[model samples]
Target chain A: MNTTATLSRIFAGIQPELDQVDALFQERATSGLAILNSASMHALASPGKRLRTALTLLAGKLNHYDFGKLLQLSVAFEMVHLATLIHDDIIDEAATRRGNPTVNALWGDKIAILLGDYYLAKTSGLIAEIENPRIDHLFADTVATVCEGTIMEMMTSGRADLTVETYFEKIKNKTACLIAACSKGGAILSDATDEQVEFLHSYGLNLGIAFQIIDDILDYTEDQSTIGKPAGNDLRQGMVTLPLIFALQEASQNGHQQQVQALLNSDEHNEKDILEVVDWVTHGYGVDLSLQEAHNYANKAREALYHFPASSDRDVLDELIDFVISRRR
Target chain B: MNTTATLSRIFAGIQPELDQVDALFQERATSGLAILNSASMHALASPGKRLRTALTLLAGKLNHYDFGKLLQLSVAFEMVHLATLIHDDIIDEAATRRGNPTVNALWGDKIAILLGDYYLAKTSGLIAEIENPRIDHLFADTVATVCEGTIMEMMTSGRADLTVETYFEKIKNKTACLIAACSKGGAILSDATDEQVEFLHSYGLNLGIAFQIIDDILDYTEDQSTIGKPAGNDLRQGMVTLPLIFALQEASQNGHQQQVQALLNSDEHNEKDILEVVDWVTHGYGVDLSLQEAHNYANKAREALYHFPASSDRDVLDELIDFVISRRR
Candidate 1:
């Protein structure tokens, strides 16, 4: 099945709740100021796949499934995801995201920065409404981890010697931690047992790892029309992701290491150089190896479901792992 | 007395606790990444006056005087203050703060932005340790208000027809709200009565208004050597603070309104035009009228303290009002 159909199938159970989440998010994003309101509405218009929202809602389904609390949690998580994307666009100097102009591109960095902070503050207020200290602490720690991960990526940019361990660490912090928080937080909101929360956390963490690994792989294999960014965009930005790391490891033994290193080390890389490296990573075993690793985590995510009894909710979560692995974008 | 001696007298009771707050801040700022660690340390090195921290500590003195909780609140407030300053420097395109290079100046805006987010995240974690839902909501709402105020300021920049009421609203949101949070939070931590909290909040709100007005006044009156920046810096940046607003009002009666409006509406302000406006505001009734407004607020702050019984803490808090109004810088 195609990505859209698969997501539709997976999200069918919680579609109403998801809509409510969107509604709440829109309400919160609206400000009295014209500029702020317009910029926020623009950001809200080009929504992502809402994977985190789905995760939160689906995780809540395993137990009590309190829609009120679950809706708030989903909206807060989505706001955080959007806020990070706004700031990330500023850092990347990105003109567009998901085929739309970024907040930083439409407005300016100053306004974009403040808008991101506003979303975060809104998230805090929403979490406080939940009246759960544990959730508050978890969300706080996750944001800090996300900041650290992004900093690590910025600091390690252009370094060809980045280890696979550091790559996992960085992606885990940048992406997986928040995804894990979504599931864990949802489970906590439903008053799930510690064991149940642990299992859901594990499932989300592994799924998130697979999700990001696929994202990195698409940077090599997919075109701009499909991926919403040019192929080899990551390489051009000096981000050494999983495929590039694997390709570099293989290139060191195959005598292509020096050429790649020179390109990475240079202040300005030509488009041709980037395409050449993209060809090597895509045509070689790098893409295949990375996909294999993504499947490994996907399987681990599936395994985590065994702890819960058979239910339609578990089935949707189970299918989500496959959707995460198979999606093109 | 000199500013130093006055502050020393006020802080004598809480000096040890202030030192502990500083120590804890340093430890939290130390990161594993070299670039992040160094950038954070550079920001930490040039500490601000810690007005928020002092407010938190002094307010806590009214009731329980719980050092542990007050310390956490104090540090968190200080971090929030510093984080806003870092982002503010980016918005201002400022190169130096407190006669030291800004994070943006030293490490670029991207790093500065991340560092600011990092501090805010740390603040969330600290507030979580306190485990108070009300405080959490307060901090979050205050942060959102601060962002809104900043966005309002940016949107209204260079508008010569800005109203006095709008100026008051902007300053209250951008400055007074957070300062008010510090006192309110400290009161909450120390188990003060709701009435006491309200009084402290009033004290903070009024003092904050007076503080910002004096700051605006100093921008026109003090030279670079005294104020750590050039005179008329706000006017040069098209800020339209209280003094300038008052001057614009006065200028309309004297037939100089059109000339000042041209300077404000221009895309780029030359030094001479800025100095001319600064001279008019300082030499005319603008400064005196603005000072009277500040004193009105300062007196309100003092009146708020009448509800509290006599204590050294009350004395210190009262003395702070004089220190705020009289300081040259």
Candidate 2:
């Protein structure tokens, strides 16, 4: 089977799991403490693509794991992701997310902080009910890794001189660790063999890296409205992702280093500067190279799953890789 | 054994466990994560009396339980408590806690929120390592309860008309639940009877309420240096605690309702207004009444331990009740 139908089937399997997220929230969250319900529900409304949850469910289905366990892990993984978002908004002082006011924006930092705590607490409660220490430890460790990744991001912000090695470490922590854990967690629950778990782990890590690189690419290529945040928002905040890093490198070679430095040193950078950087990165032929790198990672992600039995699930996995590389935003 | 000697032994048992807290930080926390590490350590240094941890150890010892289980529960309880403080500081916009600058104050709300998340993630990790599912579930549920309490506190802030019943619910979530859980968790890990666990739960709940009431009282009576925060800090933020509830009751009888209304209504609430409210509350015998309630709770807390065997551990538990009523800050 070709990749398109495969992805459609993967999306189909994810639908019911998304539905289960609400029920899990209600069951694990009824503390009878006031305002908690409202804050929690409000946070759940944040318009994320539910990427990590989808990854978990799709990976589990591809491995032919139990739907019940997959649903539980999907909810747990989503809660962890949501918890991170709640904290991130506070850090960024961001008022709007997904084109809506953030939790911190609506309620203030105090409530936002408490709500993040609430999400993690509820996540722990839900995961604990699973009654498997192995799963519990994996989930907990992933949370630690995510924290370490976030700390790296916080420290590295504003450093134009950040190395490519440091950049990969940050993305691996912030983006890939949880994604990898989602599949590893699914495989662990299904009692998959070590080789099967490792395969998915590799697939998840590579795909996650490719996914973030695509996100960085989109920062230059997409409209702000389409992205729900400003284009080059990361650059404005001093976060130099791959495309910007590559753009700076090319600009230096063309003896336009002063122009690039002037943009970074400006009192107020505007869209013109952003567009200039984008043109340099794209028109200079760096986009081809960056896209090639992304394709290589996506291809590596697919190759990691070659050990799996040839089934419809594996076909769906291949489609996900294609989707990862081709998606616009 | 008298209260002083009993309290001494409990403190002695907690000393080693307190040392363990340092190791927990040093191992799980990365040194290179400077902001995260500094904020965490700053919060940890001169930690809050280790009351919850002491209670866990004392409860276990009184029941003739092993020390190892109590130590784990103590660490878990303390971690949970510290995590809540990090989040609470964000909610309160608090500048200081335990006489030190708050995480939010020192780092900013962003780092505070992330650090709080990290502590909670670590707590879940530690708890998941222990084999008992009952204890695991209890930790998770307690977190949810604490979040509920924090949310209620946030919702009620700047709400001068908040009732005493509402205050009770808030304290139950914010303070009592985890304190209650610490004792109950210790008992669960040991061979304590079901009745024994109930006794400890009741004792902890009452003691937690009493402890908070005394804290509220001190908010009016204590010197600024001793309290660390300024007196009437809660009232400045428009919080109506127990003393205010009682004073409002008495103000109604003296036909000085207009004066009371002016105090509550003034947009220019300054040090004078704060001092005058404190005077009015103390003048109307409200402070004494609040203290009386605290004493009643102390008595009830002691009664909860009557089911336990006669031992110094039980005596320490008893003295802890007295300490709740006697603490100056």
Candidate 3:
């Protein structure tokens, strides 16, 4: 089955709740300022997978699913994700996201930055209404970690000496922690046992790691038409991801290390150099090794589901692992 | 007395608590990331007036002053202010602030943006520790207003038709809202009565309006050596503040309106054109008129204090109103 078909099947049980999340998000994101309202509406038009929202709702389903609280949690987490994506586009200086013009592309960077902050503030307001200190602290620490990860990424840009360990560290903070927070927050909202929250958090964390690893892989393996971004875009930005790190390790033994290092360390990346590095990673063991690592995490995520009983929600979450690993975009 | 001498006297009662706020800020801002740590440390080095911190501390002193919660509130609010400044400098493309190089100037916009996010995240963490939903909602709303005001400013930039009412709305959101949040947050931390909280909020709001009006006036009246930024800096950026607005109104009747309008609405401002507009606003009734408006807000601020009984803290708060209006920089 295709990705959308699979996601529809997985989320069918919570479709009504998901629709409400979208409605609430749109309602909350609307502002009195015409420019902000229009810019934000444009941004909302090109929606991502809403994976975090799904995780929150699904995790809440495993216990007491108060639709009201879960809706707030889902919307807030998704808004945080959206806010980060907007800011990330500004930092990446990318004109397109999901094959559509980015907020920064349509408006200037100043508006984009403020829009991101606006979303964050909106997220804070929603979280405050929830009035759970544990959830509040979880979301706060997750955001802080995400910021730290972004800083680390910026500081490490163009440095070919990045280790696989550090790469994992960066992605964990950048992507995984927030995903974990979503699952954990939903569990907290549902008044789940601490053990159940921990289980869901672990499930989300491992799943998130797998999600990002596949994302890095797709950056090299898929074309713009397939992935909604140019192939090897990360390499063009001098970002050394897991595949690149693995490729460099393999190239060291194959005598291509110096050339790759020189290309990456240069002030600007030419298309030729970016393509060459992409070829090296794609045609070598890098993608294969990274895929294996992703599978390992995917397996961990699958195992985490066993901690919960064999409910329909757990079944969907279990299928989500396969979807995350196999989705093209 | 000098501005510093007067401020010292006003803040003397809370010197030790102020010291602790500084220490805690420095401690909290220190990060394991070397780049972020050094940049944040540099930002902390050239501190602002810490007027928000003083307002928070003094407001808390009016009732129960729990040192721990007040410290957290003060530090969190100040960090939010610092975060906004960092992002604002990026928006303004400013190289210097308070006679010191900005984070964007020292590192780059990317790092500066991330650093601002880091501070905001740090602020959320501190506020979570306080665990008060009311304070959290107040801060979140304040930040949202601040972002709205900033976006309003950006949208209105280079438009010569900005009105005085819109100008007041802009400054109220951009500056006064956060200041109001600080005082209200302090009152909340102190467990003050609802009436006292409203009074403090009103006082901070009026005081903040006065503060920003003076700031606008200073931009025209003070040179680089005095205000730590070039005179007419706002005009150079096409920011039509109160002084420029008042001057334009005056020039409309005096037959110099077209020239000033042409100068302001132009694509780029030449130094000569900037100086010409500055001369008109500074030499005309603009400065005097703007100062009178600021004093009006100052009086409102002072009147807000009459609700509280006479005490040293209230006295200090009253003196703060005078200090705000009379400060040269």
- Candidate DockQ values, in order, are 0.84, 0.71, 0.88
DockQ, 0 to 1 scale, candidate 3: 0.88
Runs in model 3 lying further than 4 Å from the true structure: B1-5, B253-255
What digit string (tens of lDDT, one per residue) describes model 3 on residues A89-150? 99999899877899999998999999999999999999999999998899889999999999
TM value for model 3:
0.97
Clashing pairs for model 3 are: none
Model 2: per-residue Cα lDDT over A104-133, one tens digit each: 898877777777777788788778877878
TM-score of each: 0.97, 0.92, 0.97
Interface RMSD of each: 0.7, 1.2, 0.6
- Stretches > 4 Å off in candidate 1: A1-5, B1-5, B253-255
Tens-place lDDT per residue, model 3, B44-86, is 8864547889999999999998889999999999999998999
**RMSD (CA, Å), each prediction:** 1.6, 3.4, 1.5
Backbone clashes (count) for model 2: 1
lDDT of each: 0.88, 0.76, 0.89
The alpha-carbon lDDT assigned to residue B282 of candidate 2 equals 66
Off by over 4 Å in 2: A1-10, A13-18, A21-35, A46-48, A62-64, A253-267, B1-10, B29-32, B253-268
Q: Please, what are the lDDT tens digits per residue for candidate 2 over residues B197-263?
A: 8888889989999989988898888767676677777787667788887887766644554554555
